[model samples]
Target: MSDPLVIAVDSSTSATKAVVVDKSGQVLSTGKADIDLLTPGMDMYEHDPVQWWESTETAISQACAALSDADRQRIKALCITHQRESFALVDEDGGALRPAILWLDSRAGDEIKEYGSDHIHELSGKPADTTPALYKIAWLKKHEPEVLTSAHKLVDVHAYLAHHLVGRWVSAVGSADTLNLLDIANVDYSDELLDIAGVTREQMAELAQSASIIDTIKKELTDSWGIPGDVVLVAGVGDGQAAGLGTSAIDEDVAYVNIG
Candidate 1:
């Protein structure tokens, strides 16, 4: 038997990148697929939502295809790090209800001004900023009430991809925190935060601790990709935190700055 391998996927604003690596973090192979960014109106950035999963599949399949049968069998798990704050409303079967709002979207200015305050900042541990999903969700509540009320779940990138990979509606705590809905201290969804966005706890993805194994990837997906059928899906953090780990910036003296 050879050393085990894993797939690390970064689903970002522009593309999804898949890299196969050994236990020592050596890059064995890589693949990428772009995600179309839609600018339907001034200050609005959106994605078709379905493209999130599609691009991921394309990228991962391409990466796995480069490996020999032995290398493929060595693959044991996969994890995803994605753009923070981007999210979509989906039905029970994971169908998108509308275009997903991206982190850079600025259409929620009015809602941010009206609802942004010290109390919210204290609870969420994030200032009333354009990057958080809370304001955008409030925008939807006011402008698209039916869509808000009808959604079965409001999911960030981690939850959305995790569901398709593992057949569970789950998100990593670190990934979901960017939505500005979690109580920072409790590290769980907050009622006041959900109420402001017209959502309920039941409508949120089940939370998993970051770096933990949430569930196994579906055997059908693994079989199709020619990887091990028992490949598990590991819960992951947002891109910002992931970068820190990648750069070995875990100490108090070192800091990682991403200009891009």
Candidate 2:
């Protein structure tokens, strides 16, 4: 008998990659699809939310097609590891209200400067920077209050993909950490931070720890990919944390140094 299979998807800024792996951690198949990134202004970058989901679907479809029936049937998990800080505001039905702002976007410089403080840095474990999604959310609130206020959920990339895959507005705790939304020391969302970003707890995804099984892939999506609908969707962290986890750095003593 063959080993159980798992499909891991990485939804990145430039592209989405899907890799099928066996229980032994050997990759059986791989697929990738490019994502279109738009820069409307010098410091503003965005990606169509639709393209994020489509790229994921296209990548998975291509990866699964490369597997044999036996290998495919053994699939047990679908996990997603994605970019950090990028976020979108979605309607109740998981539809995007506007293009998702990318992590690289710096249009919220003024907001960052205004809200940037040691207290915020201590609370979020992130200093006011161009990378945190909080600043971008503030920018949205200032320029498009109507749209921002009307959103059913303010979510990061992981939450968006998780909703589309499993029909739940949930995000991996580690993945949402860098959004400048979480009280990292407590591993939970801070009401003060949410208020600062002009978002509410009711408008945020429920948080789950990394690798926890959150939900199952939707039947429609599974049927399209030729995978069983019962396959569990596992929660995953952002690329940085995922890399640390991959390198077996799960504690303070064990560190993952990324030397360029």
Candidate 3:
């Protein structure tokens, strides 16, 4: 029997990348596409969600196309790792309500202050900043009321991709935890937060375990992208989580930092 094939998807502020590997972690194929980050002024950064999606799709398709049929069929699972905190609002029809506010965007700094620095820090385990979803959502509602009112769901980078791949809106615990909408203690959605964001349970995606199988590749997506029918789609964790796993940083004291 051949080794099980694995694929890893990394979507971040700057780019989306996909890599195909065997059970032994030997890379077979890799592809990447960069998404342009727009900065209209100081403390304002954004990206077109449609472009991001297109880039991700192109990267994954290219990676799969680079592989031989037998290798593709052996694909056992696909994992994803995405940048934390960036968010996009989508309408009921799955169209983006507006451009995604990236993690680095700081136009919401004052809005974050309204939530109180200490309260946010205690609840989120991170200092309240422009990077947190809470502030971004608040900023959107205030500045772009029309867009916010029409939005049917607020999603992070990975959730958006998962929806496209699996035909369901699902979010990962790791990513959700960074959203400021989930309680850090219980790791579940916070009602107070949903109320603050003007969203309800029905407007949110279901949360899934980071390593659990979220869904198999849908037949239509597989057919369109020429992916094997047996490919498994694993609910990916945040980039930091995936790096910790990849580097065997399993202990609490283990530290891994990225600097660029």
Number of the predicted model whose TM-score against the real structure is largest: 1
TM-score of each: 0.97, 0.95, 0.93
RMSD per prediction, one decimal?
1.1, 1.6, 1.7
Q: What does candidate 3 score on TM?
A: 0.93
- Residue pair clashes in candidate 3: none
Off by over 4 Å in 1: none
Model 2 lDDT at residue 169: 91
Q: Identify the runs in model 3 with alpha carbons over 4 angstroms from their true place.
A: none
Rank the candidate models, highest TM-score first.
1, 2, 3
TM-score of 1: 0.97
lDDT of 3: 0.80
The residue ranges of model 2 lying beyond 4 angstroms of the native Cα positions read 249-260
| Global CA lDDT computed for model 2 | 0.90
Alpha-carbon local distance difference test for all models: 0.94, 0.90, 0.80
| TM-score computed on alpha carbons, candidate 2 | 0.95
Question: What ranking emerges by lDDT with the best candidate at the front?
Answer: 1, 2, 3
Pairs of colliding residues, candidate 1: none
